[model samples]
Target: MLVDSHCHLDHLDLSDYQNSLDRLLDTARQRGVTQFLSVGVDLPSSSRLVELAQTRDDMLVSVGVHPLQRESPPLPEVTELLSLGSQPGVVAIGETGLDNYYDKDNAEWQEQSFISHLQAGAQLRKPVIVHTREARAQTMAILRDYASTSSGGVIHCFTENWDMAKAAMDLNFMISFSGIITFRNASALREVVKKVPLENMLVETDAPWLAPVPYRGKQNEPKYVVEVAKAVAEIKGVGWQQVAEVTTANFQRLFLP
Candidate 1:
């Protein structure tokens, strides 16, 4: 079975998510996508994600502040994050990292928040759920700064180059491709996917955004992760089943590590 290593199951409109979740799972199951990780973008939603995990064994969660949110975060300290990480069904500590694509001016804050998250993941010995966009230099540097920490994490929604992917992997990070990789226009990303080794790779949907090729222009969901796996398999000239098994195993190793 395949595992969608990253997705925003809570961000989609409640009714829409509710309407489609079951069918989405059914479709994914038929398509060989058996498990998924529901990512969290901020504190409140992170809490909600944890709640969902309590009821759904197949679902897991990550907690952190999304780079896009301007609200000053509350911290009882980084221990709060470690405490959350210790909870059952909660596997990682991000959607953290940086995103200069949205607001370049917020770079400083994003870096600070991202570091706290890394340190927290270190403390908990949990892998991280990282997000980096247009800030590859800073992201890699920060990751290096904290390299001595926990095992490592995945660069979720990876859209960067081979060099960047190599750097992250050197630091022990996994490169996760989302639906964007399936787009006809994302040749560069597909090229990177081709070069990345399957043992250090993962697949995600990043739902509610970047639906795959045939499903482009519509909302994304976990079920579409199969499209990502298919695209990766095609790019790497490997069988689709091979990509599924390796990435799913990588997911379990990272989060369940």
Candidate 2:
């Protein structure tokens, strides 16, 4: 019943699965990872994910452009986001937010896009999936301004401090941890994990990247989310089964509600 709350299924390198997505998902299912949220980084990717989710009851999706996609011109409008975000199986509004670490020069553009997604989420009554890095202040400010309490969301792959985590939770956002939490140098992140309640937490792999320990050098998949859960459990001083149950419940409460 574990869920990979975030991942890019379409971007996975399926060579080890006989180049078959179904085979890859079956392997994940066999590992107890029965549900997935295949996040979209752009309109084309979003459309493909919606199509992919239509055939599988266990799959859901989020639609929006990534802030690091500086090459994708024109930025997204609220109308554009609403049009696509309203589609079936699209449970959330973004993988969107500020990413000043990679492209600080385009802060204005990213902020505009982020706000549009937030607006769309509010209007559609769907949650937003936020991706934030090195722009915590601006990210939290924009979220505080534009995010509606009724359209609560999750901060996917969170690597920020306890302050930001608490801030996001105060804004009705769950803090999702990825495989990065298992890294040897993530001791600080582990401390953050200890403080975040299981009620406000979710787990993910962000697969095709950031695989957990023992699988760190290998291509990541939804199946490896178990390792992320194991890390959270150890940090929280709880059982992995408890982590799985609580995170799955949190995921359903946020995305499927």
Candidate 3:
């Protein structure tokens, strides 16, 4: 069985699925995607994710604002993050971290939000789901300062050097690969995947985006995580089945009850 370690379920374009979330998930199930972590990027999405997971045994969730998300009046505070993350079925604290690649001028706000989410994760004893891009140093520094070994997290959609990957592993963070790893231009990322231990790796589609090759430029779904697994298997010189078993286990070990 495969687990989509990260996805934005609410953002999926379900037009072809008769606008039915169940239908989309049914398609994923047929592809051996047995479980999903529907990630949240902000307060509203987090609330929606909690509602979505409430009745689905196979679905779990993470809550926090994305680093690039502009802080609005409704942006969750540290206490609010703690409260939401404490809710049942909320297995992780964030899809949070710094992203200087997008908006360098807002570094201060991003750091504030990132630090708050880390604090919430630390306090609630829940793992965080991090998203770092072009801000590796700041991201690792914040994580090293706040993320305890007991409340470790994963760096989602990793597209970084081996140095960054090693730094994250040192902090007890698993490195999750998305379809981006399957791109022809992602050779460096592929090398990082090769070096990361199987026990410390996870796979995701980040569905509704970053669809793997053969499905690239089309809408992505959890079903396509198998392609990512297949790629990782090839990179690590292991069988695809081994990738499936190990990543599923890693997801459960890190985020499941």
Candidate 4:
């Protein structure tokens, strides 16, 4: 079965009616995604992830702040994150990192918070779900500073050039392509995905956000990760099964710790 390495299943407006998680999970499972990584962007959401994970063995979780949170920088102690990390399905330490694209004014805060999460991940020995946007050099520097060579993480929603991809890989980080890889204008990113080693590659939807081609401009969800897998397979000239197995194994090794 495939694994969705990152998805914001809790946010994204799953309000009163139609598209319930039951249906979404069933669709994903039917499409070969049996496991999921539900990422938490803040305290309330992190608590929700813990609660969500408690209900299912297949659901794993990551806890941290989105770089833009005005919530005093999510400086939760290592002990607190470790306490949560010790729980049954808490697998990773972030949806955290630099987001210079979104919150330019808070760049300093973002840098500081990113370091804190990296340290927590280092101490807890959990793979961090790193998010870098328009700040590749800074992101790499901080990661290299705080993260040991052994404690690598995933570059989630990777849309950068192969040079950036190579740099992340050099630090032992995996590059995860999200649904954006399927877009027509994402040709450059598709090329990057092709050059990346399958052994250090993964796929995600960054769901509740960048849905793939046919589904772009709408709400995204985890199940669409298969479409990303399909795009990556075509780019890499590999079979869909190979993408499934390799990325799933990458997920297990990194997030499962």
Top of the candidates by lDDT: 2
Q: Deviation in angstroms for 133 in model 2? A: 0.8
Worst lDDT window (10 residues) for model 1? 71-80
> What's the TM-score of each model vs. the native?
0.94, 0.98, 0.97, 0.94
lDDT computed for candidate 4: 0.84
Of 2 and 3, the candidate ahead on lDDT is 2
TM-score of model 2 relative to the true fold? Answer: 0.98
lDDT of 4 by residue, 151-191 (tens): 78999999888998998899889999899888888889888
Instruction: Give the C-alpha miss distance for residue 163 in model 4, angstroms.
Output: 1.5
User: Candidate 3's residue-wise lDDT over 1-257, tens digit each?
Assistant: 99999999999999999999999999989989999999999888899899889988989999999987886634459999988898889999888898989889988888888889889998888899999889988998888888877868999999989999999988889999999988999998888998999999999999989999988999999999999999999999999999999999999889873
Among these predicted structures, which one has the highest TM-score? 2
lDDT of each: 0.84, 0.93, 0.90, 0.84
Candidate 1 similarity to native, TM-score: 0.94
The digit string of per-residue lDDT tens for model 2 on 63-140 reads 999998877878898888999899999999999999988899999999999999999999999999999999999999
Candidate 3 vs candidate 4, lDDT winner: 3
TM-score of structure candidate 4: 0.94
**For model 2, which pairs clash?**
none
Candidate 1 vs 2: which has more lDDT? 2
lDDT of 3: 0.90
| Tens digit of per-residue lDDT, candidate 1, span 72-135 | 5453247767777777888889878888988998877788888888898888778888888899
